[model samples]
Structures are given as structure tokens and as C-alpha cells.
Target: MAKFEILSLITSLLAIFVSCLALYRSRKTHSELVEFEKVHVKLSRRQIEEYEAKDAARQKTTLGAKLIDSGGIRLQVSNLGEASAKDIWIRIEDPDSYNPLVSGDYKQKIPYPSLNPGEDFTLTAFIPLSVTQQVYPIALRWLNEDGTQGDFRCTVSR
Candidate 1:
């Protein structure tokens, strides 16, 4: 009887340890995401400056994304680029962190094409997520011309 009790105690402790480990891992992952978002935000700002440096040619390029309309789970990204693009590549990430929300061309640039220096463009597509929360991290990577690239980010939900 004493041996049985001891075994039970040991089993309980092991379970507790495993649960603690899982919790620790989850927190670590989420915190890493938060840190990445911060760093990316800074990098995106720097990119804006780089994109504007070409303004000397009287060319002004700007990129922005917003939730324009939602159909239950769908979302529209407005003002992704300025002109009709030959091609565009987009990456959507976890709003709470830097983790990517989807893999591959999450948002097709074909719908938006290329945005000119100041032309406006919009993309209406489904959000590749089931998350119902109203706020999260979003990151985008865009290439306007041949070698001209831009990055934009936002924290939003709808």
C-alpha cells in the first residue's frame, strides 16, 4: 500500500512538470513574436525613408494596407501600392506577434497589380485565418519596379 501511494505521488509530480514545460514554451514563443514585431516595425520605418529617397526624380512612392470591407472572414487590403505592378508578393503575419499568418502569396498582388509613385490600389481577399480577435500584427513585403522594394505593417482587426 505504501509503495502504491509513493508511485501516485511521483506520477503527479511528473504531470505537473510536463504542464509547466508546455506553459513555458508557449510563453516563450509568444514573447519572441512580440519582440519580432517590434524589430520589424522599426525596419519598415527605415524602408519608408529608403523608398522616399527616390523622390528626387520627382517620384513619390507610398504603400499602405487597411481593412476596407469584411465578409464574415474576408478582408480587403487598401492602398497596398501606388501603380499596377508586374507582380507583387505579400506576407501576412500574426497581429499579436511576428509569426506569419499564412504561407505563400497570402495576398495576390495581381488584383492590386502595381501602384505608381502615388497611384492608389486596393485588394479584396479572404483573410487566411480563423482568429476572431479585432487587433493583431500584419506585415507586408512589396516590390514596385525591378529592384525597388517596400515594406509595410499594421496592427488591426475587424
Candidate 2:
């Protein structure tokens, strides 16, 4: 009987020890999970802020081009961007072949001072009847409102 009592006491002590160990492990795991959640939330917020900033800058500048046949082939350059284009310059890749005559000026009358958003300009080009294709390649360079340089190239088709 004495031996049985001693064995029961030992078993009870072992059970208590196991319970304490399990409690300690659970608390440690919870603490680690909370720390990880904090870090993850901070990183997610920073990433969202960076993405929004880039999207805003991207929306600032956009350009659109169109070719119109109004009595003659006219190249219309429009600033469909949210901001204005400053010190805009237009250049024809091969002027001699296309024979572009803009606003009755034999020389290039490009390098307009500035073009506001939604504003546009027309350039007249006189192509010879011999050329089968009605496409003219043009290069455009300009400065943004933030003093950044922008360049674009497109083919004008009649």
C-alpha cells in the first residue's frame, strides 16, 4: 500500500510538469505570431503607399496623335496628359522625302513654347503623288512641368 501511494504521487507530479511545459510553449508561440503580424502589416502598408505614388506619377503624362485630311494631310499632336508639355519640339525624321510644309513655312516652324493639357497643334505635310504609302514618321521631344524630358515617336497615316 505504501508503494502504491508513492507511485500515485510521482504520476501526479509528472502530469503537472507536462501541463506547465505545454503552457509555456503555447505562450511562446502566441508571442511569435503577434510579432510576425505586426511586421507583415507594416510591410503591406509601405508597399501600398509606394504603389499609389508610382500610379499618380504615371497618370501625369500621356500623349495622343492623330492624322487628319482637311484639304491637306495634317498631323495633329494632342496632349491628352493630365499635365502640360513645356518647350515642345517636333522633328520629321526625313523631311526631304515627305516634303513637309507646315503653316506655309518651308523651314521647320517647330519648337512651340508650350502646350496645355487637351491642347493640340497641326502640321501640314505635302507628300508627292508618286509615294504609294501615306505614312510619315515624326519625333517629338518636350519637357514636363517637373523639368523632366520626355520623348515620343509615332507614324502619321492619312
Measured by lDDT, the strongest candidate is: 2
Q: Per-residue error at 18 for model 1, in Å?
A: 99
Top-TM-score candidate index: 2
Q: Model-by-model lDDT, in order?
A: 0.57, 0.77
Q: Estimate each model's TM-score.
A: 0.40, 0.66
Instruction: Report each candidate's C-alpha RMSD, comma-separated, in the order given.
Output: 24.7, 4.5
What's the true lDDT of residue 94 in model 2? Answer: 77
Q: Kindly report which residue pairs in candidate 2 clash with one another.
A: none
Where model 2 places Cα greater than 4 Å from the true spot, the runs are: 1-26, 31-35, 38-42, 45-49, 52-60, 103-109, 128-133
lDDT of 2 at 142: 87
> Model 1, 1-158: lDDT tens per residue?
69999999999999999999999999999999999999999999999887776552233234555555534333344443334333444445754443323323344344345555445544444444564556656665665454566567776565
Itemize residue pairs with steric clashes in candidate 1: 82-115, 82-116, 83-114, 83-115, 83-116, 84-114, 85-113, 85-114, 95-136, 95-137
User: Which residue runs does candidate 1 get wrong by more than 4 Å?
Assistant: 1-54, 57-60, 70-74, 80-86, 95-112, 117-130
